[model samples]
Target: MAFKFFDKLSQDFAELLNDKKEYNVVIEVDKEENMKSFTTHSVVLRYRLPYFDKELENATTNENHIKTIIKPNISAQIFEIILKYIYGGIVNIEDTDTKTIYELMVNADELELKELSVKLENYLIQSKASWLKTHFSFVYHSIFDSDKFKDLKKFYNDIIVKYPNLIFESEDFTSLQETALISILERDDLNVEEIKIWDYVIKWGIAQNPTLPADSKEWTKGNFKALKITLQQCLPLIRYFHIPGEVIWKKMKPYKKIFEEQLWDDMTQYFISPNEPITSLILPARIISNPELPSRVNEPFSTIIKNEHVAELSSWIDRKSTTYSLSNIPYEFKLILRGSRDGFHPKTFWNMCNGHVGTIVVAKVAGNDEIVGGYNPLSWDNSTSTSTRMCAKDSFIFSLKNGNIKNSILSRVKENDNALRYFDSNEQNVYGPLFGNCEFMMRSNVSDFTQDKQCQCKYMESPIFQIFYNYEKPIRKTIELFSIVDYEVFKVI
Candidate 1:
C-alpha cells in the first residue's frame, strides 16, 4: 500500500511541473531605480526584466557579450508616464502629472503632431491650472474659432482687469500671437475703444524688439513674418481709429517692404472694388464730444459734434439701394475724393461742392463745376420712417470731376500763397498725424485734371469720368430744355 501511494505522489509532482511556464519579456527604461536590467542573446538589455532574469546582471562573464547604452533624454517622470501610457493607454489629470502632459503637447507642436497636440490641449483645459489656462487659451485661439474659447472669457476678463496693459504685452508667444489678439477682440464684452492704445503698446513692443536689417537671415525673414501676422490680427480694430499697422511699421524700415506689401494687399482689395467708393477713398472719421457744458452763447452747438458729410452720404447710399445699387449709377462706377489729413473731411466736402467742374451745379450756369451726384443728407438716413425718402430739408448738391484730365481739375484746387501752396478755399474742420503718403498738386492742376476730353492716357483704363459725364446728360438736357420753355424760371435759385 505504501509503495502504491508513493507512486501516485510522484506522478502528481510531475503533473505540477508541467503546469508552470516562464516569460522572457523585454522592458527598456531610462532609470534602474524602479527597474531591473537583464541579459539576452549575448547583449545587455536594460529593462524591467522578470524576477528570474533580474539575476542576469550578476553574471559578469556575460559582460563580454553585453552592450552598454546611454540613458534616454527623457526625464524619470516622463518615462514612468510613458510607461503608464504603454501599459494602460491612460494618464491622470492631476497638477503634478498635468505639467508632463503640457510638455508633451509642446513637444507635439514642435514635432508637428497635430492629433497629439490637440488631445493634450483638451486635457490641459480640463486640468484648470492657471498657467495652463493661459496656454490653453492660446492653443484654442489658434486652432479653433473665437466662440470655442468663450468659456474662458471670465479668465481673460480677470487677467485684463489685473493687467489692463496686457493686451499689448507680448512675450515669446511662439506661433499663436495672431490668433490670440484677434480672439480677444472678438469677445463682445471687451472694450474695443481700448484697441488703439493697445496697438500703440504692441507697436512699442515690436519697436523694442525691432527687426534690424543686420539680424541673421532667419530672424529677419521668419520672425518678421510672425510679427506681421500678429499685426494683421489688430487690423479690424485699427480700422476704427484709422491707425493702420503701416503707421508704426514705416518707422521699422527693416521690415518696411514686407509690411507695405501686406498692407497694400489688405487695403487694396477694399479700394479696388467700385462698391465701397467712399470707404475706398476716405480714411476713417473721428468722433468729437463737447466736454464743456453749453453756455448761453454756445448753447446751439451740437451735443456730439462731428463732420457728418461722410456719414450723411453713406446713409443716403444705404437708403437709396436695397443692395448698394445707387439709382442710375453704373455698377462699376465709384466717386473718389482727394484730400489731406489736416483738413481731409472738410476738403472732401469742398471737393464735393466746388472742386469738380463737370459735376458741380455751377456747370449748369458757369461751365465751371462737375456733378458726380447730389444728396439730401437726411434723405439718405436709413432710419427714416418711410425708408425710401429722397429729399432732406438741410441738403447739399456736390459733384466729382475727371481727375485724370489735368487742366479742368486744376481750376477747382485753388492754391494759397500764404501757406506754401494749400487748398485754402474749402472750409471744414481738420486734424492731422498723417499716416499714409499722398502727393499734392498746386491749385493750377485742378482744372487740368478735371477736363471732359476723352482720356488718351493708358493708365485711365476704366474712363470713369467719361461714364459720369454721359450718365448725367439727361438731367442737364432737362434743365436746358426747361430754360427755353420759361427763361424767367432760371433766376429763382
Candidate 2:
C-alpha cells in the first residue's frame, strides 16, 4: 500500500488517542512499521524529529532507531500533512509559506542534522523556488549586523578545502549566487579569488546577486570594492592558454586610469619575452616606429647621402633613359631604379665614378628590384652577370642599435640577389632611401594615442624615394658592396 494510506491512518489514530471521551490506549513507540505494512486503512502517525532534545527522545525506541510510534490527539489533517513532509520532503497542496520551510531547515541545522538542512537548502536554490528570497535578505540584514554561525563558518571552511571532490558530486552551480547572497547577509570573509569568482558569476548570471542594495540601511559598498579588487587580481591569472592580452584590457577598460594602468603591467608579463613569438605579443604603441617617418627602414639598392650637397633623386626614372633623376644632391635614395622599362638604353649616358672620392654608397635593402642601371655610378669589376652592382640608395650602415645586422645582410644580398635589408638610421646618411614601403605599413604616431579608444588600422601609404644626388654632373665612382651586419665591401663575385 502507498505510504499516504498509512499517513491517513496514523492521523486518525492520533485523533483517537487525543480525545478524552474516547477509550485511552497505550502505544509501542517501536511498532511504526507494522502500521505502515499491515492495513491500508490503518492510521499510522509519523512525526519527524524536531530540533528539541525531547523530540529526539520521544521519537526514539529502545529496540530500533528507525521505527517509532506517536501518541497524539492531533488533528487528522495536520498529522497527515506532517507525516507527508517527513517522508517525501514535501506535502500535498496546503497553505504553507516559504518562511515555514526556511524555518524548518534552520531548525534542522540547529538540531545538528546538517545533512538534511544543507540538502533542503540546496534543493530550494536549484528549484528557483525560494519564495524565501526575502527571508534570505532579512538574514543578510541580521548577519550584516553581527557575526553569528561560528560553527557553520568552520564547516564552510572545511567544505571549501575539499571543494573539488565535494562540489563535483553535488548539484550546486560552480558559482553559486547564494554564496554571495550569504556573504552579504552574514558578513562572511572571502578571499580575493573567491570574491572574483563570485563577481564574474553574478555579473554573467551564472550566480545570483545578494538582496541588499547599495543604498539600503544594511548595505555598504565594501562588497563592491571587494569585487573590483577580485577582478583586478584575476586579469593576470587568466593567460594560461595564450588568449590575446588586449581582450582582457577591453573587459577591464571602464575602470579609472590607475586601474587601467596597472592592468598593462599585469598583461605585459605574459605578452612579452625574448622566446615568445611576435604573433603572441601585444606591445604598447610606443615601441614601434612612426609610419609618418619613413626613414627608419633600410633596403637593398637604397643609398644614404651623408653629404647634404649631393643631389637627391626622385623614386621614378624617366622612361627614356638609364639614368635615375638626379645623381649629386646628398640624401637617401633608392639604388635600383625600377619602372616599366628594364634593358640597356645605349642612348643613356653613364658617368663612371670612383668609390673613395665619389661618395660612400651602400646596397641590399630588404626588398625586390633590379641592382644595376645608368644611375648605378659604381662600375662593375667583371662581366655583367658576374659583378655585384653598388646601390646608390637601398641599404643601411652598420650600427649597434639596429641589430648591427649590416655585414651578414649584405653578404646574403650579394649571394641571393633577392634580399631586402633592414637597419636603423640615426641621420648620418642623408642620401639613403630613408625607409622601405613595407616598414611604413606597421606603425602610427604618438600624438594620435589619446584620440584612439581602441587599436586602429595602420593605413600608411607606400614608400616613394626621392634621389638626393646630382645626375647632371659627370663623376667617377668605384662600386663596392657591404654586408648589412658585417660592413666589409664585397669583392667581384
Candidate 3:
C-alpha cells in the first residue's frame, strides 16, 4: 500500500519535470548554437536548489515576469541530466560512460548540490572501481585541480597504493603534476626501493623543462639548477639515511651541490660514523607499508631515532589489527632510545621494559659500530633470576648491522614453539637466552668480546646453527638491514 503512494508521487514529479515549458523561467546551459534550455519553475528551484533560487533572484527579467539564466561552464547535456535530478529526484545514468559521469560530478559540485555530488562520487567509486583504476591519473588530476573534491582525492590515492605501477611506470608518470608526483613519493607502501624512488625523482625533475634535453646525460649545470627549483619542496622528503653510503657518495654525490652544507655534513656523518648518534632531521621508517595493519609491532624502545617519529607509529599501533584481516609487517625500524641519552643501566630501562613482553631490544656495538639485537617474547621483570629458563621458547637474537647469520638461526618467524630464550641479564643492556652471563652469541662470540672474556664467566649458549656478525658488510647481502628504533614502547591495539 505504501509503495503505491511513492509510485504515484514519482510519476507526478516526472510528469512535472517533462512539462517544463509551462514554467515561467528558462535556464540556458550553453551559448553555442543549437544549445539547450531547461524549463524549470522558480518555486521548485527556490525550495530545492539554493543555487538556482539565487540565480533566479539575480536573473534578468522581462515585462511578463519571465526570467532566463545562463550557465557558462555546463553543457546542455549535463544540465538535462541535472535538471531531472533537481525536479524529479531521479538520476538515471544507465550506460553512461565514466567520463561523462565525471563531468556530471564536476558540474554537480559547481552547482553546490552537496548531496547529489556525494551520491555521484560514491557511484563512481563502487560501480566503476576498475574504470577508476585505469583512469587513475586523469581522475587524480581532475581532483587535484579543485580542492572541493576531497573525497575523490582520498579515493584516488587509496587505489594508487594498491597498484603503484599506475603511477610509477604508467605513461602518465612523468607528466603528472608536481604535487601529484610528490604525493606518490611520500607514501611508504610504494613497493619501490629508496634508490629507485630517488632515480624517479630525478626523472620527474628533468621532465619539467621542455627547453632542456630529455636525456639527463645531456643535462648541464643549468639543467640541474632548473630542476633544483622544481624539486625544492620534494628534496627533503627523501629518506637519505636509508640509502647506502656507497650510493650516496657515488650516485647522490653528483647532486650534492644542491643540498645545504649542514645537511650534506649530516649525511656524511650518518654514512661514515655508524656508532655516532645522528642529530640530523631524518624521518623514521614509515609505519604502514600494507593496506591493513599488522597484528604485532615492536614495542617502543630506544635506538637512533628520536621522539618526533612516534606520532605516526602510535597511531598505527592504536588502529592495527588484533585478529582480523592481518597485514604483512615491514622490516622497517625507528630509533626510540639510546643508552647515551636514556642511561645504559638495565634499571634505567625498567619502566619501559618491565610490563611489555614481545619487546625487541637493539643495541649498537660500541667499537665495531655493528647493530645487534634480540626479540624477547617474555616480560622483563626486575626480579627475574639469572637461572631463568627458556619457557617462552620464541625469543631469538640476530645480526642486522652487518655479518652473515651463520646458520638458520634468525629466520623471520610468524610463531614457533622452539624459539631461542635468554636469561642472566645485568643492570646493563645484556639479556638473551643464548647465554647466562655477559657474552656475545653465535660465531663472532669468540672473535673479540669472547676472547676478552666480556661476559662475567660462562660459555655463550649455542644455537641450532651458528650466526655471525660483520660490521663493514654482511656476508650475505640480504642481511644488510637495520632500523633505528623510533619508539621503544608500542603495542598493537
Each candidate's TM vs. the true structure? 0.27, 0.24, 0.51
Q: Best candidate, TM-score-wise?
A: 3
Backbone clashes in candidate 3 total 28
Compared with the true structure, all predictions reach lDDT values of 0.32, 0.29, 0.56
lDDT of 3 by residue, 1-493 (tens): 3445766776687789778467888888776875788777888888778887678879999897789998867888888888888877888775466688989998998888889899999877654553465466677776776778777777766555654644565445677788877777787666656776788887777677668776666778887788889889888888888889998888888777667788899999988896787667886554335454222334433343223223223223223223112122221233333455664433445545555444555444443434444455456555556534343334444344234323312322222323333334452244322321122232123222222223221121343223322111122223222222211332211
Cα distance off (Å), candidate 2, residue 160: 15
Q: List candidate 2 stretches off by more than 4 Å.
A: 1-9, 13-51, 54-242, 256-263, 272-493
- TM-score winner, 2 or 3: 3
RMSD values, in order shown: 32.9, 34.5, 21.0
Worst 10 residues of 1 by lDDT: 484-493
| lDDT per residue (tens digit) for residues 378-480 in model 1 | 1111122321212122222323232332221111111111111113332122211110010111111122212222111111124463332211121121212
Worst lDDT run of 10 residues, candidate 2, spans 484-493
Candidate 1 Cα outliers beyond 4 Å, as residue runs? 1-76, 85-98, 104-127, 136-190, 194-237, 241-493
The candidate with the higher lDDT, 1 or 2, is 1
